[model samples]
Target: MLSHTRKNKILEILKRHKQISTQELEKQLSVSGATIRNDLTQLEEKGLIKRIHGGAVLPERESKNSFRSFHKRSEKNVEEKKAIGKVAKNYIENGQTIILDASSTVLYLLPYLTQYEKLTVITNGIYTALELKNEEDFNVILLGGIVRPKSGSVEGLIGSCMLNDISANLMITSAHGFNVKNGLTDFNFYEVELKKKMVEKSDRLIAVLDHTKIGHTSAAQFASSSEIDLLITDSQINDKDLKEIKDSGIEIIIGK
Candidate 1:
């Protein structure tokens, strides 16, 4: 009945069965539904499993470098990201089709979207899609692709073919880092590839970032400075970097 022992049992089940539903977990462990969900989240965070709809699956590991936890990354700079989300929502209007990437920071924007109606959302984020699934006022589209457990996103660009049929008014995204020269860069190569299609399909782009990302560059460039219409970040950003981004012809908002 101990938590660790229960989790070990769940892993053993995953090893034997490959995947199991929440109901099965509850029955097998003789625990409440809430406990099973909590254990799954913990296991997913540790890069041990991938949380899918109503169940969990084992992570596919190519190497040690494959285990990047998007949820844990989202937990950092909580107040800052919330502020950025607030600023980002101001540009969004009702009754418009929008694209959203699966970055942890973009997840913060979800809470502020209930005010809008008749909004069509296209996204490759499994967690993001699940959050919006029950909203009666919004039409949610989850793209088809390879799902990455650590990133909690659907990548590999297979879902990008859907973008050719639909165009969005705007797209909201986050990057691992950004610099005046390299623009918005991301550490995930698969995510970067999908975001490129998202950029081409949307009329405008809004970047949601924390101050730490400013003036830094990552593995790949997804958006150049000229391609972004607006950059929203926490107030902790210094003046020089702020002015440089603003000078690049991209509007900027400092969330307080």
Candidate 2:
């Protein structure tokens, strides 16, 4: 069986059972114990599953950190995310190429962006690409990679190589959390790795975050304060965090 197929099978079993022992996975998939363990490590690295002593289960907490919750992590703070997305749309216009990461907060910008007549959107978001489809004069390129079943977004860096030869007017995304020190962070290392590539290939980096995500930190840091050109967040962000944001010299747009 292909590695991806075998790995996916393991994930299916885990999802159905909620957790499964390495030995049982080997029995069901007819793969070696070593292979099953390696698969679990890969899934864990992507933040898809949590490994216990002898098995793996779904992540204990919601995926990712930022208002994206990783990808559309629920509607916990929907109104706040929409407000931030409105701020994000202000930076975009017609005839620009942009990279949009697959996050619920970033997802909110799609409706606002549909007003553009000529736009090229490059994204790792499966749902995002679908939303952009059928728009007049809009070209949507879905980054090629492994799709995380839960988030409906592509994972792994297989698709990021395309960005090396392409430059975008902007790259917009949300994070698991942020701090002046770590900058932007998320739970999955591979997602962060690809976001780093997008950051390098874009002219300006914009982080759209909700106030709740202002002070937190996640496992992996994708971009730092200096790399980000602007931050658009909700108004509830505290005075102290706002002060830190200003001190970092990154322009901020506080949404009403």
Candidate 3:
């Protein structure tokens, strides 16, 4: 198998089993113990896991502000995220004010955003702003606030106040979790508050989510099911989940 793929599988195994020995991976992948040790060493350098005397273990759960967690999470569900981003790009028009949230899923929209010109894109994502800063045709507004390094988001009153006077034609967002009952929820309180404000200030709230976010719930609540204007997700989403979201009177756009 490819080295990166093998490493990712190693991570998965470590996460579930807590700790994995080099001999175990050698037996599983039909590789030598030395190869497994090399893989573990690489993962350690990436900070995805910790290497003990004879095995590797998934790192302890750190604060949500931890960069390691955010970076690892952002690398997951990448294909589905690209599909969601592709669908979201189709809705943007030239010169329209678009507000995008700081979620990693929404970050996929950056590469596909080349079509719009002279547009106003407002966001609280530090990474997102940096991605678009070189586009001369776009007016990029980076919301100034307390930076949450783990999530790569900017939050607090500074961001909220900047959003108050600005209304967007479209607001593209994502959440850590969603449920039919709780609606859109987030793990961070500051992010939840900012997302709610973005919804209220925009004409349409489009949620760009991967299939994994379905039927989940997080710590903070933002909007009810009815508040979202559109839900853009991957085609891999379950039929039952699609039906439930549509049943709530929201438009569902599954990426083709």
Provide the lDDT at 192 for model 3.
71
Per-residue error at 50 for model 2, in Å?
10
Give the TM-score (vs. native) of candidate 3: 0.73
Assess the local accuracy of residue 215 in candidate 2 as a C-alpha lDDT between 0 and 100.
88
* lDDT to native, each model: 0.85, 0.82, 0.81
**Which candidate has the highest lDDT of all?**
1
Question: Each model's number of backbone clashes?
Answer: 0, 3, 0
For 1-256, candidate 3 gives per-residue lDDT tens digits of 8675577568657756878888888888887888898988866764567899888877784122223455677798899998889899988998899999888888888998887788899999888998999999999999989887767889877889999899899998898777777888865556677888988999988888889889777655688788888889898888888888878888889876
Task: Write down the worst ten-residue block by lDDT for model 1.
Answer: 59-68
State the local distance difference test value for candidate 2.
0.82
Where does candidate 3 stray beyond 4 Å?
A: 1-68
Question: Which segments of model 2 are wrong by more than 4 Å?
Answer: 1-74
RMSD of 2: 5.3
Model 2, residue 177: C-alpha shift (Å): 0.9
TM-score of 1: 0.73
